[model samples]
Target chain A: MKCWLLILLILFSQSTLSADFAVIVSATSGIDVLSSERIRDIFLKKRRFAQGKRLVPVNLLGSKPPRLAFERRILEMDRLNLQQYWTASHFKGVTPPATQASLASVKLFIEKVDGAIGYLPIEMVDDRVKVIYEF
Target chain B: MSFRLRVIVLMTVLSLAPYIVTMIVMGNVYRDDYERRIRDNMTHELDITNERIEQSFQSLRKDMAFIASLDTMDDLLTGDLDKRITNLLVLKKNDMQLIGWFDVIDTDGNVVASSNPDRIATSADSSGLFSVPIRSSFDDNQLGQLTIHYSFENLDRFLPESEHSHYHLIVEDQQVTGPLNTDPVISVSRVLTDWPAVTVTLEQERQFAFSLLNSAENLFVIVLLVGIFVIASIAFFVATIIVKPILQLSGTAESITQTQDYSQRVAINRNDEIGQLSHSFNLMINGMQDMISRLKAENENRIKLAKEKDRAEMLQDLSTKLSRYLSPQIYESIFSGEQDTTLGSSRKKLTVFFSDIVDFTSTTDQMESEDLTNLLNQYLKEMSDIALRYGATIDKYIGDAIMIFFGDPKTLGVSEDAKACIEMALEMQRRVRELKSEWGAAGYSKPFSIRIGIHTGYCTVGNFGTENRLDYTIIGSAVNLASRIEGQAEPGTVFVSEDTQLLVRDHFSMTPTSTFTPKGFSQPIQLFRVISSGVTRSEIVIEESGFSLKLDSQELTEAGRQDIKTRLLNLIDDL
Candidate 1:
């Protein structure tokens, strides 16, 4: 009975940790929040401008934990589905979001650029950027 | 040296000197030009190789820059997670056949994209053979760099390779491509303008670079040898042609001198100068032969002429001795072909003269035979000289008597001949008187005197003898009468017959004398004594046993008169 309780506690902490990521922008962006659909449209190049300003979107490279969580929870797509969607948008002259090789590069890019948006682990996000969305 | 050898040497030198000189000069020029061309060719090849290498590098840089300028490279701003720049790098590497990999490095020094998949997301530095900086398309800030790991093998395609020559790519003082030649006759290098640390070099081997010059030198030597041989051979042939005749000529001359024979001649076979020389030599020999034969003939003729001259001189000597036995008129007539020498006679009116030495027999009995002969010869010689002066032809000498006549072989008229004979008799008496005094002075008390008789008559005068012996004489009564008249003459008196006296009576004074008849005469002949010429002058005549004289004052020179007076005084003192 104790081993069962311990397994359940481990499972709960793992979920909490997996969900600790955010979509952030520069603090001076004057953007207060974003919805999942709007964030998806901007990342997939369906919406080129937001809040009367052009949006620049950035992503962590490959399948990082934050990138995977953003793709699954906000974009509502698996890794294969998201790649397929970008591939389809590619023929329409639409490109997927820009990518950084590390979470640090993603955080730095959002902090330095206005109208810039990117996903990072909640622990890596700094005060130089504002959190627009969380998953 | 022999003429042929000398000529050959001279001709070889003459023909080959210019050839060798020109060959050397041209060889030098050709070698220089060939070396220059070879170097120029090497340089040109190196230039082409350098240009190709440069062009390749330039094209690579341009492609890199073009790729770097692409917005696809802007993916470097997002770290190129989509592999957009990586895909482009891979494509460029394949298209250019690059042997090295390409990478896109971000400003953070991380390789975001790479042609080599293993290098993706790797940290990289911008150190490579070639690099192009990536800039942000939005603000032109430094983003990343497009870099290539350049392989020297890429330049190997432009490097030319051959057996004797090779090309090398030197990068930062290291040989990158192509084999390094250890010993090169020629080395050409060019540094890359864009890639400053790289150099292109061409190396050529010694054998390959100078092959043409070596072959050309060999050919020149061969040609020079052949030319010398040909020139020497031609010179030898020509020298023989020219010298053979001269040798033959010298030989002929030597033989001729040794043998002293001019009959030898050179054979003429050509019309060149040598042949002309032989012809002239033959002509000279012919002339010599002709002269020798003519001289021999002249010598023989001279010998024969000398023998003939000797014989002619002997005949003349014989004729001269024989002439003493004949009268001058008769000898001249016979020799001149006017008279024939045969026994014959002729009758003609002639004046005949006879002379006899007085007391010759008595004087001969009293003296030696030699003294008697000398006295008789003296008396006859004086009388004969007078007789010849009067144009008398002497018939013969009989002992102490002489018989002569004028007329017949050559004559005046009979009267004129008679007158000449009387005058001759008178002069003979006078000479006899003079000889008496000369004999007294010569120590002979008794000397010779001559009495002459002359007559004018007809006689037979001719040659009378056998064929081997002959005499020219007169035989007739008139000749006997002239002898009988001489027998009546005194020792120093002249007596003439009436016939002679009558013919000379107008020119001389004569008195009738006693007549005498001979045994062979039938009638007595009247004779006369001649005294002097018709011009009468003071004269003297004296005769004695030991003294006699006859003088004509009208004929005496003053000196002669003085001489006579001196002689008379001496004679009177002696008396």
Candidate 2:
């Protein structure tokens, strides 16, 4: 039975987590239903637009707890691993995502900046910042 | 290579061998470690790549599903297929690595839809369409077996190119659903059963080993170059310090030998074995020099001794000859070593006289041997005395004949020598007359007569000899004719040669004697008889006075006095 449980956990960990990154827009805004690939592209600076609107991506500081959790769940990168990744990114002149101090700061930035996108836990949901995609 | 260079190179090789080995070993270890790390990291990177691919596929699928679930998708599905294809074309154009999309096949093997009609070989075949059930909004009804083929290359944006395109996956296949390391990836298969048509896809992942080995190899090449340079420099320094001196010494020694300089010793300044060797070489040179000098000195001494001995032997031979034949007076005169007789020749005027006892041979014929020896000794002694007293030399004595000359084997003069000779001849005649008188008083009945001759002329007097011995004598025709004059005289006569009479023609009163053929002559010689009894030794008697001397009537007695008187007359005649 324990072997069965251990196998079950291994199987569970092997499965892709149903994490999503949303390229969200305001309810008053015009974009909807972005593909997770498009969201990844925009976050990684590989693309510049969602639908027709230019993407304005906001992020938390790399060392921030929420940022670490966000990268793990969405980008699927640990902090140490992300550090190495960004270090390589910095060499390419493709800066990692711009950072904010907190969820509040991200919300404030999203409200001010056009087409701004940010992420937070579901419980931190607010009306100001629109979640683009979730992972 | 020079010995120093070789030694330095060897030493450097020996010295650096360990480091070279260590570097090589470390390089290998690091290479392995780097390769291992790249592999381990590649595994994780590949996992991330797969997840991204899956994510991309899921998003593509969701987009397709959304389109299929859209009111337009249903409208297009029910309507012409061109509208649906146009929408998928738009989606495909959104990403670069993505090719055109395809629709899934149901279990009934029907192609529901596709972005590109060419994506399927045939509509009824459905071999390339996906048929797997995908999760959707309604778990009941099973999402109507909807499946979609994603372009699948959107993951390249996030992953490195080496890891992005070298893999493939099959999401619905359990054996290949996990992380992969190669191409033709199938992240999602729209198939419900094994026989269901499925979309086979490719993902991104390539081998990182090539780059890993390349970096290690590059690092190794660079390190090796640096290591070789460092080793060479160290080797050069070592050789310069250690081996150069020994080489110099060797060449120096070679030069010394070639130069044949045994005394050329090396001078090594260092306090080492070579220095000691140089010192020893100097000592050996000194010893050799000393031995050579000693030998040279000894050789020189030996030569000097040999020359001195030859000189001494010559002197001894000369001394022995001197002692054998020389009288004391002559020895002293001749061997004084300062006197020179070897070149003794002189022109001098001299008077020569010759005399012979008349019939002395017959007188000795009957005498006893003792009486004859006594008589000859007395005669010779008395005649020699008279010759010496008148400053004349007894030139020779031939039996009872006497020859005398005044002037020297030693002196050089003319007129004085002639005068002295005349005086001596007169004295000789006088002494003979006195001797005859004494013999008569002793009553020896065998009377002897002497004949006398006198001449005056220039003569050469010096030593004349054969190879072995020499005699000092006067040589001239003057001496020869004087002997002739003596022989021509009668038993009581004293005669003078014409040569003498000519010199004293007016000064001497001479009676012309008869001419006669003489011995050893082809012609006759004229002789003169000079009167001589009034001649005295102290008086310069003039021959023109015509003096005569009185004596016994025996011819021997009368000839003796007459010879004395004739010599005085000859002196006054001034020849």
Candidate 3:
């Protein structure tokens, strides 16, 4: 019901757009905290290390719910703008974050890959992934 | 004022007129232009500042949108769990130094996370520049609104002091907040297209901006005032240069006119027009001095000539008066030194004639003085001419009578003088006849008949008068006898004393008219009535009328003549 209301608000007005997302990392990543900027840089492939660890960033699939939240909140881009951003990054030899199929998949990816960061819903969070940033 | 001062003032005015006008016109134009340009500059700066402020807000909105779009926002969407969202907002606030604070509000309008941990779960205060929405990006879902608060200290840095004065204001729901700068040159209001409920305002003080604009005009005024002083001093110097010599010349002219002293001249010397004028003025003064001297000489000469003429007129007038008072013979004798005008007398044989008009006093009493004078002049002129022509010396005139004498001064002999005197007397009576007829035609009704008495006597004839005035006349019994004989003479006849008749008996015939014992005479004297002289001395003719009356007063006494005249008058009355 809350999602429907949010959908109704976005359909009617982009000026009233609202978003909330979280930045997550593996429990063994050795990064207890991250600023919103470091989170965005890692997800956009602009950064590779934080706290002296080689960082890897993961995203849900483009059709999945958290991918939009990750791109909009962390990367600060819309879907079309993100696509254009990736295309421009390709010429610079950079790529988008690695994709996962679901929230659990993102959680599992963050859990296994050391120095890996991803985004997830608050409810989908557990002790396996560390919450670095939230909006 | 003096001429030099006047000239200086005039020149200063003449030269400064255009400058003063320009100052007035330029000052007005500059003031007007400054006001317009200051307003325009204020408006222009306001526009630029308004654009910058809108850009700042857009940047702030973008910052808010970006922070809301974070993947961590899903944490808040699906239950924030702890202080994770608040920590993220703290970092975001640090990124935007202008932000007062940031709060992530839940969809239910609760402050889920904020830079201030105390603000968490508190209902978000929406009072700020703008409150942007946070959305679920993948589903286009409304999550919460991100309310941004701006720090005035940081935002004020966006406006510069070089803009003279500026203020930023917000108008929301008809309520205004921010700096209230009244008396602003420009007040600009802007409603951003992205945020309709929010309005931004900018303002600048007119006084502050106009102060900078006044600099050019103030500088011009200073320069103009200094120029005026320099020009006025120059005008004063020039006027002194030109007017000094002219003033000197006028001073000389003024003194000359006051005293009529043409000899004075201006003593100024210069190298300009005034020098030439001074030279000409001196020449004119010299010429006037020469003319004045010449005119004075001529005037003196005229006065000397007039004095000579006055002396000559005095001599002529004295001669005329002396001739009127004295007989021509006596006057000539004195003037010619033939007789001395001293108080003395001498016995000389002189023929004297006395003549008088009948009823002369009655004739004058009946006439006006002008007519009487005419008759006397005509009679005296005729008698004098005849007397002078016959060489008789006129003694004097007593009213209508004349007594004259011949001999002594010039004489052929005593006998000849007597004969000439008798002839003059008869001719005088004849002239009266002719004159009376002529005078009657000129309004004189009464005719005059004359009687003459002649006497030849040895008489004292010389000056007999006081020391101051002399009377050159004859005196003694011979002169008296002539007067008495004239009184006894009948009208229209000449009576002669025996001495005269004895001297003229051969030249004229006489009638034994009367004899009388005259006053102071011891014996009666014989007299004769002489009727003619020169050609026909006497021819007694008689014509008888029907009745005849005759009287011989010689046979009677004086009382007998009077008695007979009264008896005859009574007899005529009876008849």
lDDT measured at residue A38 in model 1 versus the true structure, 0 to 100: 96
Counting only residues 3 or more apart in sequence or on different chains, how many pairs clash (N, Cα, C under 3 Å) in candidate 1?
Answer: 0
Model 1 lDDT tens row, B427-490: 8877776787787887776677778788788898888889898888888888888888888887
Model 1 TM:
0.44
Cα deviation in Å at residue B512, candidate 2?
81
- Model 3 chain B: weakest 10-residue lDDT segment is B537-546
Candidate 3 local lDDT, B108-214, one digit each (tens) = 88887878678777877657557777765333467788887665445456556544465554545453445455564645556645456655555666676566646
How far in Å is the alpha carbon of B569 misplaced in model 3? 13
Per residue, candidate 2 scores C-alpha lDDT tens digits across B250-269 of 76668766885666656668
Q: How many backbone clashes does candidate 3 have?
A: 23
Task: Arrange candidates, best lDDT first.
Answer: 1, 3, 2
**Which candidate would rank higher by TM-score, 2 or 3?**
3
DockQ, Cα level, model 3:
0.03
Q: Which whole-number lDDT from 0 to 100 does residue B38 have in model 3?
A: 62
Model 3 alpha-carbon drift over 4 Å, by segment: A1-135, B1-48, B71-131, B143-155, B162-261, B264-272, B298-467, B472-481, B487-512, B515-575
What local lDDT does model 2 show for residue B490?
59
